[model samples]
Target: MKLIIISGRSGSGKSTALQALEDVGFYCIDNLPAPLLPDLVNQILRDPDHPNKLAVSIDARNQHSNLKQFPDIYKRLRETRRLDCEVIYLDSSETTLLQRYSATRRKHPLSDDSQGLQQAISYEKQLLEPVSDLAAIRIDTTRLSLYELRDSIKLRVARRQEQELSLQFESFGYKHGIPLDVDFTFDVRCLPNPYWVPELRGYTGQEQPVIEFLEQQPEVQQMLADITGFLEKWLPLFEKNNRSYITVGIGCTGGQHRSVFLSERLAGHFRATMDNVQIRHRELN
Candidate 1:
């Protein structure tokens, strides 16, 4: 089994990271106390039908002060079980953590009458250093958006999947919002706003009327022509550069109409020719 121990500071998005792991198919346990790790691993190893990927979260909530216990447990587990273990350390700046605490209106785990959240955070950081240094992957969540963080975890998990060229196309609307996780963005407002047409306002480009309208417009034709040419020229280059995935985002005004249609069309285009492509309408109503 692949054992992943996710550890980090209190407000560094450890819960979010664990949820991301769970989303990607890992059997996840949240707030697992450090001292019980060895016994848990032993039980799992004894079960032949155990899950292939297992993730457990360890943090300040655990009363294990002997920081040395984690490495020792890991060494012993490695010797006994056919397990590959990796530690993922999630961390963020004190200022960001303080902001998170204030936003959530939650008291810090280590804070007391004399010490503030900042002080508590500092204390926890020192206490967790031994395990943090043992991490194979250390991620600073200070600047990471939730989607970006999830995508990062997915990328790591995807490494175990067969090595294949993958592409993800996402569609969104600027008014509803831009896709935060897009690697490349294309603005379709240049074509036409389907929102303007009273009849097509509620309909998406996946329908016949919207497709016919878009196909008739000179600008739409030109835009698709140019983008298709660009993809023909650049996709091979992306492969040459050793990229496993490329996300192309298409956006318009309202997510329900134009962007949805264009995204569907773009996905269909890639589906006919590309090797591996996953498409999602991020802001589709």
Candidate 2:
């Protein structure tokens, strides 16, 4: 059986992720007690018609002591060779979490009359530290829209098999800030810039003008080889340990040209070699 344990702070879109998993046919259970997990798995195993896929939603609402015991339970579950378990933790920036709570007018799970919203958010983060440490995949949902979040959960989470690694090569601009969820980030601002050319200033890396300009730069080829070689050497180590996701961020001064081209080239090369690969241009979108 394959189990996906979804845990996140309040308002970080765990509900949406659970919904997406359910839509994809996982039998989902919400707020399951940490102690009951073993029993549940055993019961499912005994049943003849049990769905092979299971998703469980866990959060800070569990008793304080129970939450502390989670790591041991998770360790035992992992020890059982019959089950393949992956933990996904979703997180957002404090500013984004505050904004979301304000927009929805919903009480945070940790908040009360004595606690301020910020205090509640901080406490929840501290409270969930054990589970956070065990997460095989961590997603930053601060910048995701409802549609994008749903799509990500469907594409990156539900679709990936237990043994498969979902890889993403993303392009971003330095001025905009780095992507929080990527496992590795490469800065390619030193490479030749298509923006220097008057005619290619407005075109993105996907366009022929920008692509041609970048293709002619020998430094760009060398950079790609170095980065690709490093990933090739280390990525299988992550996969062998059952990593569910790997995100590589490629950044330039502006996301429109060099970064986008390299991200495309790297993703294209790996897609043919890997099970699931994705490419995203953050600034371009």
TM-score of each: 0.56, 0.95
**Model 2: per-residue Cα lDDT over 215-280, one tens digit each:** 889999999999999999999999897677899999999899999999999999998898788888
Query: Ten-residue segment with the worst summed lDDT in candidate 2?
Result: 142-151
Residues 78-153 of candidate 1: C-alpha lDDT, one tens digit per residue: 6764787777788887888989999999999889999988899999998888788677556666656788767767
Q: TM-score: which candidate is best?
A: 2
Best by lDDT: 2
Clashing pairs in 1: none
Candidate 2 lDDT score at position 174: 96
lDDT score for residue 221 of model 2: 95
lDDT scores in order: 0.75, 0.90
Error of 1 at 145 (Å): 1.2
